[model samples]
Target: MLKFLKIFCASMIASALAFSVAAKEPECTFSATEVYERIADNIVKIISFSIDQHRVLERVRPGIGSGIEIEPGLILTNYHVVQGAKLIGASTNDWAFEAQFLGGDPVLDLALLRVPFYERNFVAPEFGAYNDLDVGQRAYVLGYPLGVGLTLSEGLVSGLDRQIPLNTLSWTTRYIQTDAAVSPGSSGGALLDDCGRIIGLVSMISSHPQAENMGYALPIDSIMPLVGEIEEKGYVSRPWHGLYGQMMTPLIATLLLTDPASVPEGFMVETVEPGSAAEKIGIKGGFLPVMWGFSEILIGGDVITHVNGQPIRSREDALKTVGALEVGDVISLTVWRDGVSLELQAELEERRNFESDLWVNGQR
Candidate 1:
């Protein structure tokens, strides 16, 4: 009887423990007021200063932006905010702290700053499950807009995996689109979920008057992995092969006014960045430029038939294969040049900066 009693007591205790654990988990949903109250202190104001030693100082009005505290003493902001700044600072209503630029990636528009002595008193934010998020979910934006005080705005997620073009170069990082009202200074702010967890980093807003209220943010899920690498090495080591082009199709041949049979179906090499792996492998780019739709395409370059052993039929396939590669990895390419098939091999290298190269269609 005593043995049975003990076993029953143990079962009851286990049930109670399970209930306790479940009760400790915070609710997945939170009200707007609850979210603001929870994460208000996590948002910060960024000050960017451009110093000229030659000029006598009158009054230096710094550029204003927003940032979010990712960890104690570590703040994350847009790279453009502090891109060429001589000095940077982070501020709250009470305390102003001098910030040091730790490391950043221009392509991702992410920068990490460190406030040497400041320690956060509030609880660290939990990252929202980005994969679980769906369209029409509640999205709250917290930032210092127009150099004014901290503001909170709420809206629904309008879209996901949005690929917005940045000048001549296409933004490789897909952004999350929200209807939340973000302004000039709202860059580098936090885009929070209903549970007060960060899901995206507010980057830019639609500048066109017709497209008002459209704000885009970098997915926090993508940035989180790069954040660790930046913390470790001061920058993201993105692999660079320096081959930029579009996939040759029947439509392209039609647009080029060439016979479809003569132009092979493969990745058409447009321009290879100088000193890149593609150039090292003796790959050639097109010399004849033709207007295809809104964009210009070169017609006389080598067509990549295969990479390693896999067929290169679409641009997506090439991107997937190259994106999986790391620096120093060897790659073999099969190219068709003037009715001759040539096999070439090269090792990948690290991409440091492509901001200046963007004007020349430098995307790899």
Candidate 2:
């Protein structure tokens, strides 16, 4: 076995060009030529933060984060990037310098950072838009997937008009669908188009058994605003809504839209917990019923229409419209009840209280 391995090793080295193990990277693995230029040209190392001490030791501490030099010293990354660190990078000649975070938005997972004035300008990566993206479009992911460094993978858009789960005190939701090839450390990375104009930010991947390639990206529409806001306020200003729900399909849509011979779009109430933001505002939910198969097995409840003045055409629309709001906001809702459409006004409520009422822990 040992002799056979040596022969194989000699063959590999001889075939490739007798490369020195100490001087060169592995022949089979990703090569320097594939990345060194890109890394040298684009990749910025994410430096973990060191403890801050002494309020008086002030000497202009630099904040460092991984970034793609969009236009010279102008870098772009997730807000969480330079959250508490200094930005540092290397020059074309391999000379390193410290950069600073100009601004950022945690809500959108995008940020703008600036490198100190240097002799040579850095080339910016292309930004693409998803306005023309279709459900079946071939999507390519370019970023440090798995924190492994610049890598590329391909997958279908799989879906669109997707609303991610809300787990915050403020209502915040956006359109995102699952795709394969996204993983941890990919967050804040670009989910690019073939032209790479910056379609979305790879934000999260799913954790469900049925969810492979169930990754979500913050759409460009939502991310661009964050880039500007972070520049103005050093943070993102998110909107608010009181209701939370899963998307309704055509079947679910029928129940929410109307039962009569006429009506088009809306959402069926899947599960509305008691005393929720929706409940507090007089939203209705279904009563218990036996699961007997039938034409309209979907239980009746509040069929949501417009939230904060936006129409809820489907379950995904309802979630995204409502998730983008903050607490204490007042929103007007158009609901369908018993085949009739009605308008109602509501004020946003804290989710923690509602969650507490949900799990019986008294705290959420």
Candidate 3:
């Protein structure tokens, strides 16, 4: 009888431990209606109007997208929403105001606006770190789709750190992929986490006609640095070195006839714009194009190892290092060329329409 009692006690203990663990787990399910009620007032419908050169009203475009007031008198939305708009207006549940476009980063599809006269209490969205998010975590999207009033959709983070091209801007950007239902009028809405914090800004949806619930958002973390720049200068004066390159990998190192383990990973220069900082500093672009396993990569160019004393392992590392520099700041780049390592210095210039210039030049 004592043996049987001991076995029963063991079973009871296991059951209690399991129950404790289950109780300690966080509740993943949340009411969409409750979330909408809590944040609906924070979301605003953006109306953009196109005006002619004579300043006459041309056309009224309603429901361009939704925006959020990130601070008192400050609004955040997508750049494309107000790309060519002459007049921008925003409306909350009970208030309407005119907003002035302060600045935008087309590469990131982020725009900052100022509601100069708005004095009422505005919701300052709490931003959450993208790094803290995990795949399969619940995500909620709030916006106006198809010109319909405020709508909320729920989904999971399908992917992260996805690279997508923005054909409108002739550039590409990183995005957080989600299965949330987003439509034409959802471009500038907010992607909230389970705690109702802003984690990303809704950007685009899949182009496939049959695609459903495939949407992408610009992660807030990536745009935080640019926000500060826009606030201070009214625009982002992004610094540029005038070079195009790709991050070097082990296979690239092998193709260059260098030991993959011996060479430090960095950007391998492919094209250096003529008369730019890179060319002025004697940086060479690739001389020949070669195919390695069906991927064509330009060979015989300098491999950048470091920027401003920081080791660059990826494109993000190089961009971050450059983005922090002011125009006219001299940046030092360590490069590997002809089996010899050398340090080169270049003064950053204010970035212009480099992409368009490249495209125009390619046609010639």
Q: What Cα-based lDDT does every candidate model obtain?
A: 0.74, 0.51, 0.69
Steric clash pairs (candidate 1): none
Candidate 3 stretches greater than 4 Å from native:
1-29, 51-63, 116-121, 165-174, 206-213, 252-264, 271-275, 286-301, 314-320, 338-340, 353-364
lDDT of 3 by residue, 180-262 (tens): 78878787888987777788988777553334456778888877778878877766776567776677788777877768887
TM-scores for the candidates: 0.77, 0.57, 0.74
Q: Cα deviation of 194 in candidate 1 (Å)?
A: 2.9
**Is candidate 1 or 2 superior in TM-score?**
1
Residue runs of model 1 more than 4 Å from their true location after superposition: 1-28, 52-61, 117-120, 167-171, 208-210, 245-253, 258-270, 284-305, 313-316, 336-341, 355-364
lDDT of 2 by residue, 177-202 (tens): 54548655555555655344456766
- Whole-structure CA lDDT of model 1: 0.74
lDDT of 1 by residue, 1-364 (tens): 0000011121223323432111222346577899998888889999898765566864454677899988887899888778768889899785788899999987777889998645446578878866777767778999998888999998877667565444212324566878888887898899988889899999877543234466878888888888878877888896677776667888767765668888777888888778888888889998898854334567788899988988888766776787688898998889998879889999998876766522223321
Which ten contiguous residues of candidate 1 have the minimum total lDDT? 1-10
Name the weakest run of 10 consecutive residues (lDDT summed) in model 2: 1-10
Ranking by lDDT: 1, 3, 2
Q: In terms of lDDT, which candidate is strongest?
A: 1
Between prediction 1 and prediction 3, which has the larger TM-score?
A: 1
